[model samples]
Target: MGLVNKTRITDNLAVIIGNQHIDVIATEDFPFDVQIRFIKTDDAQLDDGSGKKVFTPEYQMAFAAAYKGKSAFFSNTEDIKSFTKQLKEIKELFEFATLNKQTWFDTASFDGVLSQKVGSL
Candidate 1:
């Protein structure tokens, strides 16, 4: 199964598997290939004292970027299209964040950089 209640955080970012499952945030079309960050939001253990793992749906996000070096010539069109779609979804998430007047940076380390780039969004 796929992720449920998917939410976009930016044009190049999204929040899937949050609130109920693992907090998964993704970014695409960056300087590097598609990058995704996963966060754990829920309690690590259940209240019943059982050792069973919690359900966290896994999903894939896509993005497009130019291949460097000798790999450029071996690129596949289908893969590129899929990646572009994923990148577009991430961008939509970013737009959503801007509209909601939210900060993209969750940590103090990136606050300065995010502030400078906020104007571009």
Candidate 2:
């Protein structure tokens, strides 16, 4: 599974992960150094037959702006647009980390030769 581009419809943003839809919300202070939260829409189970619903923690991304050698804030439309650009990069990093973790586990028990082969590929 991979992170898909967020679709904007009106005032809300939708991020697709696997078959799930996650909503992104801005913090109370919108036009400033703010944090964005990713909320999962479904309560899916993480364990098989455990009956325990998967608890997806809120994922947040923050951005701070600086101007004239001091801390600046988002004050215009451009600032909000820049924040969205940063959000895209953050999502990519999140997906990369997930993929790396999976690859690490898949090769963790490999023998030395196999490990080297996989590393070189």
Candidate 3:
């Protein structure tokens, strides 16, 4: 969720994905428009009565790290592959919990992701 600052009047809205706050930087208002579109689709299912809904923070952070670290090159492919595999394991755990009607520890938080991935082992 990157938002380019348009005018001084527009309040920047963003998703706190992890340690970093992603903001869009563009020359014009088009950045805001693009962000809005992402919000519409991304936040669609995250609607509770209070309007706060669950989001996959773990997924977001993982992606953030992957992109920021740029771990897809030959030199970093192993790291990327390892991280992806960890996420896949978490996905499996999430699916199993859902299937069994078992409570899943929150996977939408940074701590939750770390705990499930690192603490479990």
Whole-model Cα lDDT per candidate? 0.39, 0.35, 0.29
lDDT for predicted candidate 1 compared with the true structure: 0.39
Top-scoring candidate (lDDT): 1
Off by over 4 Å in 2: 1-72, 104-121
TM per candidate comes to 0.32, 0.27, 0.24
User: For residues 11-67, what per-residue lDDT tens digits would candidate 1 score against the true structure?
Assistant: 555555433232335454342232332222323333445765444322222223333
Model 1 lDDT, residue 19, Cα:
31
**What is the C-alpha lDDT profile of model 2 across 9-111, one tens digit per residue?**
2232223323232333333433323222222223334655677545432222222222222444689999778767655644553444344433332233221
Per-model RMSD to reference: 12.9, 16.2, 15.6
Q: Rank the candidates by lDDT, best first.
A: 1, 2, 3
Global lDDT of model 2: 0.35
Q: Candidate 2, 104: how far from true, in Å?
A: 4.6
Give candidate 2's TM-score.
Answer: 0.27
Error of 1 at 89 (Å): 1.3
* Candidate 3 C-alpha lDDT tens digits along 5-107: 2222123222222222222222232211212101111222455678765553341211111133323344577866855664454344334333422121221
On TM-score, the leading prediction is: 1
